[model samples]
Target chain A: MIERIESFRRRRPRLLEERVTLAHGAGGKASAALVDAVFVEAFRNPLLEPLCDGAVIDLPGGERLVISTDSFVVQPRTFPGGSIGQLAVHGTANDLAVSGAVPQWISAAFVLEEGFPIAELKQIAADMAAAAAETGVQIVTGDTKVVPKGAADGVFVTTTGVGVIPAGRDLSARSVRPGDKVLLSGSMGDHGMAVMLARGDLAIEADIRSDTASVSPLVESLLAAAPSTRWLRDATRGGVGTVCNELAQACGLGVLLDEEKLPVRPMVAGACELLGIDPLYVANEGKIVAVVAAEETEAAIAALRSHPLGADAAEVGEILEEPAQTVVVRTGFGGTRIVDMLVGDPLPRIC
Target chain B: MIERIESFRRRRPRLLEERVTLAHGAGGKASAALVDAVFVEAFRNPLLEPLCDGAVIDLPGGERLVISTDSFVVQPRTFPGGSIGQLAVHGTANDLAVSGAVPQWISAAFVLEEGFPIAELKQIAADMAAAAAETGVQIVTGDTKVVPKGAADGVFVTTTGVGVIPAGRDLSARSVRPGDKVLLSGSMGDHGMAVMLARGDLAIEADIRSDTASVSPLVESLLAAAPSTRWLRDATRGGVGTVCNELAQACGLGVLLDEEKLPVRPMVAGACELLGIDPLYVANEGKIVAVVAAEETEAAIAALRSHPLGADAAEVGEILEEPAQTVVVRTGFGGTRIVDMLVGDPLPRIC
Candidate 1:
């Protein structure tokens, strides 16, 4: 069986490169291809078939379990508004939350550089604890490993979260249909810009803070009000453009986004313009993209708006039947243009 | 309530060092201090109180879940008998297995350095898949992050596993008694020596292979034969000595080991002798130290020896009532000496 699986995997598309590039981790086409050719092809299973934000496991007693893991290697360990520790917790928790699960237990593993500051490590743990507490989750288990001084940056944290999905709350892109409403939880580009400014390599300054936060509360509210929501996703590494492109491809439908309806803060928009980057491609740590039934759009938006994290929520797009497996953006100037996943991220290691 | 927990945690011990040292991750006294002051104090919760290899969580419907996370940062990505990927899978699975749980699913998160070899990454994924398949477990989900070449080592894989405990089975240090017998599953020092030789830093070489295979089958067999087993632990990072010391401390009992009965292969013994290191302090990736009731020792040893992974199983020690919270070895030369956890590992990054 192992030999058969290996042979089957080898017949798939090859990565065709000696070394991995930044593009392979950009959460775009190259990233998808790498994962497909390497991991998914080798470890194929029914639970991973959907390629959703998290894998849902059916228990013996009619309960559903959701599990997700994420590794954070963000440069400049500490940035405006949050640190890597907090991001590690929120990232995994958000994955579970968007999958319609109530985030519960999390396990953290840390790889630290030999000479990393002990004070900073403590601060990171404190940040993680605070975030987990606020989200009503527990950091149940953890492991720590230290490497030689030059072997690692400062610290990298990997967090795995487990949650229980409420009965009758299945969410997946396969459930999306034409005319479904696409909603944005809040503004974009804050996290990317904040990390860039923190790096101080661009000689540009901005007073933007990362929107790194837990979106579980907002998700609970939205699910309670709009139980028929088709799907939900967090726009983290690849931002909104990549998310919409993935959804379009996964659902085998077209997504028509309106640029005028995009919730972009003025400062974030100005920063992206200055950096020669598209706001749509910048990461947002504390945002969600939801597809709801057209009739339930009002309830979804209203429920999201009641939360502090979703105060700026807006209906930014709609699913379409034409131009299958693609994302098209309607510009403020009344022209439509295709928005493909960026070949590579403009700001690497932003999250 | 959250504020109260945070405030209470703040009054615990502090990590008073300016920078982290190798000792902080050595799985010794310093490591314990670091974990207590930083992580345990911050993330205190009922599920983590045992501080065992894995955390056991009770579900709403009387089902028990075991979860564990570990990050592999071995210097040589591929050692003689296993690669980091295999170790990542087996390490996490063994944690769940030893906790008397049926290993079910795992999630892997990887942080790869930009420019790392794609072939190596593919090989790692293949190894992980094979290990998971052999263990009857699934790699349900994963995340990948890439850091700039200089910011990270070649690659680091963190695996988190989840499993369900079978009914009528309970294992913990608290279940250990003064009359319990300690058994070593197989030979020691193979993994640590193999990794050291693979590094090629030392002038000596040996034909030692790492014992980095899954022990879940062996564990299940033992449980079937001796349902009264008190505790099971894998002697991984800090080896059997550290595990015995921890068990002794946790159970408030003393352990007395017969040095002549330790199951160490001749090659590993010779290598350790040449390197001036004790086999007891060397890591073993696939070996386990099980404590069972005195009456069940025969059944436990018989069951372990029947398994391929535990062909060299031996009863090496016994728990004692006197000299609590310590380990003493009865040397072959007719004397006894205390065997405490090392101040720091002689071989760092051995996994």
Candidate 2:
């Protein structure tokens, strides 16, 4: 772990930007740079050194705790199939779930614009309550603050979730081995496409709904079937491509994706094509990417397919021994292309 | 506990406004009404029924954990004595401290507006690191999101803190008895006045600084000296007056404050007078109001006085057996007046 931290420090690039841009929050290279250079350096500690979706801590009493925090700023507040309230709860809970923990409690804080509608706020709160109930977590504490009219958009929610990791259930990206297979749950780009269409900024339309649901159930089934799972992550923000890059960087290895095996809904693919965006780099809220031992690949796919949220789960990629710290895709056209972490924003505030 | 919950439900007023107002976030009557009517009712559960600053959970392992969340949206980002970064850490940590817990870990979520300066962000993060270090807490996990320029203020931070409750420590507002004495740690309104002055909206100026420091040390010393302490709360948001009102409402009793005994810095008092606001209803970050058994009043004051942050510790009030749910102040002019929870926005975004 010390060596990993040292390597991470060595790889961090110097930040030269004088001002923040949309790229800084795009969950791509700029976001990673900001977090690595500013936050990780300032709050350096062993518990945070992993740079995992959630921070894991071992209590003096032998209890393992996982905690994660996320702030939701999706545009329009209301989007197809979901609202910020539901997304906020699922977002934090999914982080814990991916870390091999069962989310138990959550704290929500809301920042509201002065003239925002109270009815909308109540509806958002209701959505949050419903999501918490379905996710089997309790909203135990919260805070609310209001800014002047122009100081904020309609509403923003920040949720922090606490979960407990079961014994013998240690999963991490660093555990990835040479022949690990990457399994993805469901299709890609549905969430980002739905939110973009909901904004009505584009003339083109599609029958897409944001796949914004808690992935805990799918995670539990997968882990139960494939006990040797190396790593798991919810493909949010910068989507599957970004998550793959992170996994490769953490393990000091490379990843190879078979484009023919990737899952994508027709509507999402069309929308991405029309917008000149790659579905692989779009955000996802309900989907997860899992790396499992090659021997357990069939069992992992079977377990995920049995879950309702993972009906489309498939083996999409494999971990590579060569070209350390890079991600390459084997295109259907019999060619290979390097897929790097997203550099600029094609769609902002999608999640 | 059921009866308390029932009473809370009975007293909650209907929310009639169609839109949220600045007063709704002023940490006063409107804020309480919105929380009770919207959040409490939606997220109703036993753990959140008490409406304490932090929620205390008893783990199956015989360990007690307390969690609290707060959002800081103070205007200007930087203020006299502290930046929003420092205030964010202190605010959440203080919540856990007042709940008789030792703050151990914190998670921060930042929402940054596009085009914000990177240097300012670095300074803010540094301030947060300093505050966390001073309070002996670790920032283990965090997330960041960026919004367009007009969508949000410069920076808004939401922090969630987790702490552990020591063995045999059970402090609660419901434990307040009629004869319990109230002890204040330090001066009131310093933080509020300082922030307001820093905004430069008023021509009147004074050498006042925000008292935005963690109150954990003061709480520890007071609890050590007064083992029978009933309740502890920081004077934030709606200030000491609102805290007293909440105590009276929670315990079904009355609070009697001696105006002359309340500690107020000369500058803060003068500024409040000029602004036509009462110091008792203004905010303070580093101050605490403690409810202790009558017999331990002197010991509690002595313990507080020994701490640098609590040098102005004094016995300012006592619990009353009559006039349930009322807070009255006995003025130096030999008259008594009801000190109701603030009704309007005398100070918005003061925290």
Candidate 3:
């Protein structure tokens, strides 16, 4: 059903629900529908048409810059490995980094609920500052707003980042070819499982921490080694499966993955299996899915493995020409099945 | 006390509250204390030291860019003159404009409640699009996150804008001199009073609508006519009185205001008097406070009056050399009193 860009823009979104649900923000089919129908249709412009993780703009002075924004509303505020503040910084910076830009400056906006403790707010701010410092970006400007008690959760942080794209470096999903190989930075489902366990609702438990981190170092190393990489995307809310599906749809190609080759930590796999969830659909904050030229696979994997964040990097998939706009997975039992975008929110507020 | 920039940085914020209150977000003394103690102290850097509405960055290629962010949490998403969506766009864009930049791009982040109606969201998006188009800015990148029903009120939008600042132009509150004149673009207290009445909590009502609008045209006209303008700021939270107080503190000079010349709509004045609130401390969305060289006062006022939004533009005050960092108002009865930053929020979620 996915074809040329013009046809996609001309297609009207068909939403059946009158009220928004959690599914609409789960970074899956429902989320795409909401964004395309409500936002893309209203703010349709050439710059925003691609719906990439970030928007790339050509300045009047012949320079290119990338801008990305994300809001952190993760439950619990402080997760196992990261707080909303750190996620607020890393999440937006990763968008710019994966877009082949050097993230530089960030703007933070906070929505605080009245009666929230000042001590906790201090810890969050310190975490944000440390994250920004580690990511090599500055929080240059910000705003704060407070609502009455119960109007909002403890606190919500929204960060926007801007970075300059190096000349002659263009990364896009539309460049994926049949022979392009898919590489994942590391294990999946850790972030989602960790957050779920942190919520303390599920009785089943194992030691799993959210991989909330900046993937800039990994991205820089991969780009340096595999200059012919076609595209890169940080596997966030919907994880590797959703990202592959989006790539297939964008390029009118197919993605074929080997389940055995996919990287998943033992604890995360066990938690997902017990919960009846698919590891491929669970979120990972520090992982990236990259498409590279077939010949560059070895070099890319080696470069990724050199970084601590990508120690378990693996080549798990490849592009196909037969089944356009689809993702297929080869089961370890010598069977194959088509994987689709998540229909409902199996795990909400994973990020 | 504000003799040198370094001294301000060395002076630590003294906050007595153990928990954040509504005053911490009211753009007043408590808010300043919180920002200085928590954010400024944690993220101390040269770019963020001034605490300007926006941060100005010099790109590697020598081009100057201004970035600003603001979050909208108005209790009633839909108000008289505009909705939260429009305010999200206009508010951030005005910050860039007052910083002498042409707002070009905006990134919007929405924190939504689970059960918000899709129809309302569509309307809000439409309003945002219209406002961006009218303000000559584009909503280039965006994100949406949904929380469970009670986790958030309805919808909160955080917008960050990037703009280009023309060369040979610099605006800072520290440039004010003893004889510099203060000019206000239009009437005050309309926005806060209108929002207060919109809540239906008060029995007294008037025909006062919010003066929410884009002040880019007015700012441009004033700057073009009077190139010697020292600084400019939009009177948003805490109103014109608070803005003047900030200027006084920043420049280490006293502000002397002529109350008789301060423009106020009859309905707004009546509402403020009935509610025992000072019109000077109430918020205004479209008004601008400008400090200009004494010799160019007439030109500045004339330019401001030329715009429809500035029809009530008036020269209401002047900078003083005595009683440094203080703001004193000469009442119509030949008496004077100190005008301080708002102590607490009289109108919460007024946008």
Model 3, runs deviating above 4 Å: A1-13, A45-53, B1-13, B45-53
Q: In what order do the candidates fall by lDDT, top score first?
A: 2, 3, 1
In model 3, what are the clashing residue pairs, if there are any? none
> Which CAPRI tier for candidate 2?
medium
Colliding pairs, model 1: none
Leading candidate by DockQ: 2
Candidate 3's error at B184, in angstroms? 0.5
In model 2, the Cα lDDT at residue B264 comes to 93
lDDT of each: 0.85, 0.87, 0.86
Q: Rank the candidates by DockQ, best first.
A: 2, 3, 1
lDDT of 3 by residue, A253-342 (tens): 889999999999999999898999999999989999999999999999999999999999999999999699889999999999999877
**Fnat for every candidate:** 0.68, 0.71, 0.72
- State which candidate, 1 or 3, has the greater DockQ: 3
Candidate achieving higher TM-score, 1 or 2: 2
Model 2 reaches what TM-score against the true structure?
0.97
Can you give the lDDT of residue A149 in candidate 1? 91
Residue A270 displacement in candidate 2 (angstroms) = 1.3
Model 2 Cα shift for residue B124 (angstroms): 0.4
lDDT of 2 by residue, A225-335 (tens): 999999998999999998888778788898999998999999999888888999999999999999999999999999999988999999999999978988999999999
Per-model TM-score on C-alpha atoms: 0.95, 0.97, 0.96
Clash list (residue pairs), candidate 2: none
